[model samples]
Target: MSFIPVNEPLLNGNEKKYLAECIDTGWISSEGPFIQRFEKEFAESVGRKYAIAVSNGTAALDAAVEALGLAPGDEVILPTFTIISCISQIVRAGLVPVLVDSDPVTWNMDVTQVEAKISPRTKAIMAVHIYGLPIDMAPLLDIARRYGLKVIEDAAEMHGQTYHGRPCGSFGDISIFSFYPNKHITTGEGGMIVTNDDHLASECRSLRNLCFQPHKRFVHERLGWNLRMTNLQAALGVAQLERLPEFVQRKRQMGALYQSGLAGVSGLQLPLASTSYAENIYWVFGVILDASVPFDAEEAMRRLGKMGIGTRPFFWSMHEQPVFQKMGLFCGERHPVSENMSRRGFYVPSGLGLTQEQQETVIDAVRTIMDS
Candidate 1:
């Protein structure tokens, strides 16, 4: 059999058509029409009043952090189980990043632990929706409200997901989405920061455009990086946004097929299909080795690779990261669930472009590898 990669992006909508339009019009820069259209439409879709497009998800984070006006040495509590982008911006902004472990079942940050981590220096809570599931946002939001802390929601993996009938992106003071190929909607490499706050939205717009002064043409007051998204990327984003509904439906169907196919498979722990508030969108169909399994995620991925299958390991706990450890962060800290997940978890081939046949091949290969 041919090699089955982990994530094959789907771009069968108006992507080519839009790209052609961009090419023919010679409007390929950040000033193109699609930029504002994508931003406006995306903001409306997510129930946000404004959206500022940026170069990538990390840039979106960087912009969100600065726009919120978090001062240096302020603390931001975030999950240790999330991508480095979540904490990296916090650290880069000279803010303290406090760690919390993952909920073993949902693999999201343990909302209960968040309050305990809060200190007088804590200024915000960064709630990251992991994989396909929105974090337990209601409680997290409540925690933020009670503490008067801002919430920077990382909805990168959740495009159309909801929590208790509320949209995922709408919960935070500022929410971010990524348009990487693997996401439900792809802009090749782009991201957006959305919020209802007018001042914050203005701040983010300025931040992504190098903090250019509105009145002065060539002057800088405070520092900001150029992380502007191009018209070409926005053109792709506009097309993908049009098909988000159908794409989400397809993702659910694929997740159902995988769950049904792999049910009762021994020594593998599947992602929870749903919580009381939200059904997983299955951004990626992840599996965790039962502690009883003899090998770790690396070994499992190695075996899958040999079987012509592709897999990706789960995020290593930020608390235990070498970079953070060297900085004397999370020192002597032990988050058992996050550490165990990093070792035992890996996601199989789950992408918006996945086909039934390819999914079946992945399933069979997973069984072959795990049953061995």
Candidate 2:
């Protein structure tokens, strides 16, 4: 009986070969050929005109937010059920964060609630694709268009997903991706910002490099962070990008396996496999404990841990975060759907490298616990 982790990166492709090439050519830093190559190919893949590689997903968000040149009191509408990086960057850029609740079915930002959250000061909408599902982007785009607001698509968990046949990352004014080990692709730690606007692309490039002046290096006109991605990471990213189609197919198969194996299990609500917008890539095989169930995700996770099976809780709603509460932000805000999911939802092993046998073992363990 071996422990099964919640997520693992599949690096069977040219990961090692690319790293070796970087080492052999002594092009391991951010200024190497692979950086440009990765950026170019990734932009093309997502149907964007330009892409800028950055140190990590957080950096990508920071640079993108900064590029917007948002005013101190400008408002940015985002989902309550998203990673803190999404909200933190907005706050850091001197913008106010306004939150919308999640759709009970899709587990994504409920577009219906978005209109009520908008105000005269609203400047942008950050559409975060949750888990493996793309948010219903068409209406969100419509809202943005009507209000003259910018859209920032966080496609970190939705690499290969699409909406109405259009790519997830292609919908935003500026889109971002994370190459964390748990993501569909891995550069160990890397990120990219993609946009169709040439000026914004150039701005992102400058922001990623400590705002270095084109002719006079180090004499910066604007303050920026050194958030450049290394060539070694870009090399790995290029290889991963090449295999994205195959990786997406494999993920779908894995999701199907979990659905079949865990179907009919009592007190468990499985992740949605597909919706009208797009099929779930099943980033992780998440499940929510039914309200009827006596235990919460924490207790269920504890039980799974005792059985040597790894589990992870879902993202806590931004409205409920202690830091935000302390800052007097999102005061009295209640996103019921997100709050419920945060407490009851937990994902089991759903890595791209997960074998059929290991998946079955996880299913069995889950079924056993539910039955008890």
What TM-score against the true fold does each predicted structure earn? 0.99, 0.99
Which regions of candidate 2 fall more than 4 Å away from where they truly are? none
Cα deviation at 229, candidate 2, in Å, is: 0.5
In model 1, which runs have C-alpha deviations exceeding 4 angstroms? Answer: none
The local distance difference test score of each candidate is 0.91, 0.91
- Model 1 agreement with the true structure over 77-165: per-residue lDDT tens digits: 99999899888878887999989999999999999999999999999999999989999888888988898999999999999899987
Model 2 Cα lDDT, one tens digit per residue, 180-257:
999888899999999999889989999988888979996878899999999999999999999999999999999999
The TM-score measured for candidate 1 stands at: 0.99
In angstroms, give how far residue 130 of model 1 lies from its true place.
0.3
In candidate 1, the residue pairs with backbone N, CA or C atoms under 3 Å apart (3 or more residues apart, or in different chains) clash, namely: none
